[model samples]
Target: MPNEYPSLFSPAKIGNLTLPNTLAVAPMTRVTATQEGVPTETMRRYYERFSRGGFGLVITEGSFIDEKFSQTYAYQPGLANVEQATGWSPIVDAIHAYGARAVAQIQHAGALSQGNRYRDGTIAPSAVQPRGEQMNFYRGEGPYPTPRQMSDEEIIDVINSFGRAAALAIKNGGFDGVEIHGANGYLLDQFLTDYTNLRHDRWGGNVEGRLSVSVEVAKSVRCAVGEQTPVGIRISQGKVNDFMHRWSETEAGAELIFGTLAQAGVDYIHVTEFEAWKPAFGEEGHSLVSLARKYAPGVAIIANGNLHDPVRALEMLGDGADVIALGRGALSNPDWPHRVSGDMALSTFDRDLLAPIADIKAAEVV
Candidate 1:
């Protein structure tokens, strides 16, 4: 059969790496790693399934960058050391065997940390308490603890950790690219958020100040990986806790955020929203994906949200996105690309797949 969604299945590029298609599996937290942050055999199988299912690129779940405040959940994978990074080698080999490019999404959890084995407390740009309660699924209860404000020295160390982690990911984990987790209310987003970052120094106060950490992290990752490796950053307006957040500066903010990251030498920018097609600001404004394309013309744009529907996915490609990343859709239909191209019915996601704990189930491995 002729490919109905030509744009969605077309070949694409990010940096020097070429993808089989524009379909990518968005990074998702499964909490299936070992206690010491090492990637497990189960994780290898779980990620390999996506590649086998015809995904052009597979971005791993947010792996903690350092042993300090970067870890957010228990059993979350990390690239902090050689052991953890080396543990991912088999998984990278598996993905590559199936001809899918893999990217490691490195992150710092910062203040939203519900669990961190290495640290006694959390740290952030400021000491403000986050807006919402901890997620029950991630094994948390009650309001979040107010994080201690990070010192200047600590901030510099955190920046260095990102660079070191990126290097580790490529050197040991054998990843094709690195993605800085700057979205979803993580450490980078905490700095970007106005309420969370109230400092008057160079790292806070204004939008540029708030965005400084993310841009710096981008530069750090780019430097660590060099000019040839694909480096990207994920940007979003919503938080895992507070889902309704939006940029106050609107389009102007979008321009600054995307442009600065592109200027920092990132090869791509991944923009995600609750709904990728919806307007970013008011009822009729351009979507965040469109704004990203407008500002970062030279960089690849990956759009993620509730873009499970092929029509919506194709529409986004027309809007500005070079690739469509699916979370729930990919979870349900791992062979989404094959199903769409072959005109097969896609499966619906079952909530039981993530019930009780969001670990990778045995049934999902095959």
Candidate 2:
């Protein structure tokens, strides 16, 4: 018999926020935003579906914070202005009304800004071209346009932008919290992986050096959001540029990212994997979540990726993750949490059609 979750429905307090349960919605880019980069009705409805279905929390798709250079993809949402926030306020309010906490994930595309029409150039840790093909989101090329090497000033600017974004997310946009997009080989992960960050400055060299900017961003965001708002960072061993990419050769490398971010006052850590249950580091005696709990001590950890059923979700909680984020599972089965709690059989989701439904705007077209 599968291990039961006596505490699955139990409330978990994250930072100052008390969630209804241990389940959370991972922040995944929906790739659909209003023309001026605001939260559209489509997005609100998309998220509300999950919230109404009993998701404990819903982390919105990535919203670009720095418009000058960080607006990486076309149609990507932005938090650089008040107008966008005005559009976003309702979405957050809607999520809260349904009893689910709302969090906005702020991201900068760095070199992955394929259709990045916001500026003449983008920034990356180093100038080495990404090794993977660009997604169809950018209709123009392979890999992506090479990004400009960020100057010291530009680097500091990017870090501060994230802090400011967090402020707007809470005060102006009505978000309950914020998550730093540190994974999937984006801006923060670029600094973590050696294949991308080939710099000789304060932001590069060993694990400590590479982790500086990400940790600094967390520290800054904490200060900006104050001690009350929950803040989390997403990290993954894989990369958008290189799917098979592994940032650290050992668990020590993973520890550097996890421990340092936790020390910086991050309220939660979202660790992602192609499959959440796999061994994050072989030498580490446990899975990624186990290692996170071991090193961070008390920080809440959210694990995401391919969690297919209630049995798997229950297993993840048993594995040491404080919360489990479902992507495909939640999209197809909107009533997943309720169904699991009520003893209803889980729905069978068609993997091939999930992306469109995941991208579907339930309230508005375009």
Candidate 3:
């Protein structure tokens, strides 16, 4: 009765906001911003073209929340200052004009911040050195520096910074909402994982304790943004530096994490994996999206990772993903949604395309 990709074109709800379709441009780091962390024209055109090409929602690249400690790369944008928000305003307006909702992905880099210039030091839940060297693409070199453990006061400061950044993004930059970056082994993810979070304090010990920082930040951001705005968190079992990682605990560990966030009243949870449709763990048939649906039925589920194929994307949507996020898919074809809907030929994603930056620049959009 329905087209093969009907759900992909159908409207979906995240909190009180309704998107025209289930396709979203996943948050990616595009080092096109100014050194001072303001959005640039190149970045504007990059996102604008995606909206104009018919994507339903465009999530901006991760924007650091705290100037002092959250910055991760040179030219990475920030929402900590008014000028940064002002720079993002026109880009958000352009996306809205093209009928797509724009959501800012707020982040704190923690120990993975090799390009951070605000301070000479890095801080994490614990002083552990992360598993791998920084990606050279981000201008990072050599082994990662050992980070200082975050103090209780510093933790609170980071949480408040997320709240302030969310408020600034929506109230000042005109983003439709904010998505907290609790994924990709960033600051929030550092707190979520046991290997990185070796603290015995309230912040870490077990799964529940590891999840406390993210939960608190979500509550703070929600309170700052209010009930009308959609606030979600992006989470993953893996990190950029370590892709093969998984929860050391059982599946119940995931339930506890998702359950706790849903109870905190986050509008949605974005779950990412190397393959969106595959089972989350060894021999387990349930995918992360299904797991999220099971754990947090009341919350919207956004499934990301390797969803470049139209058939696979449709299958994932059918499998209970309220929204499908495209990373490299969108990277290659800015008109991915339109092309798939119309059965048009699509471009292939080249790893070389990610050479200097994450976002596709105007010159590279052939």
Predicted structure with the largest TM-score when compared to the true one:
1
Candidate 1 to truth, TM: 0.99
RMSD for each of the candidates: 0.8, 2.7, 1.5
Q: List the residue pairs that clash in candidate 3.
A: none
The whole-model C-alpha lDDT of candidate 2 against the native structure comes to 0.80
Residue-level lDDT of model 3, residues 1-366, one tens digit each, is: 225578798998999999989999999898889999999877887888889888899999999997799999988999999999889999998899889999999999999998987899799999999888987878888888999999999999999999999999998999999999999999999999988999999999989899999999999999999999999999998899999888887579878988999998899999999998988888777888888989997899999999989889888887888999998899888888888888888998888877765544566433
How accurate locally, in lDDT, is each candidate?
0.93, 0.80, 0.90
What's the true lDDT of residue 187 in model 2? 86
How many clashes (backbone atoms < 3 Å, residues ≥3 apart in a chain or on different chains) does model 2 have? 0
* lDDT tens digits by residue: candidate 2, 170-189: 88999999999999988888
Model 3 residue 260 distance off true place after TM-score fit, in angstroms: 0.4
lDDT (Cα, 0-100) at 290 in candidate 1: 95
Candidate 1 has which clashing residue pairs, if any? none
Of candidates 3 and 2, the better by lDDT: 3
- Cα displacement (angstroms), candidate 3, residue 78, comes to 0.3
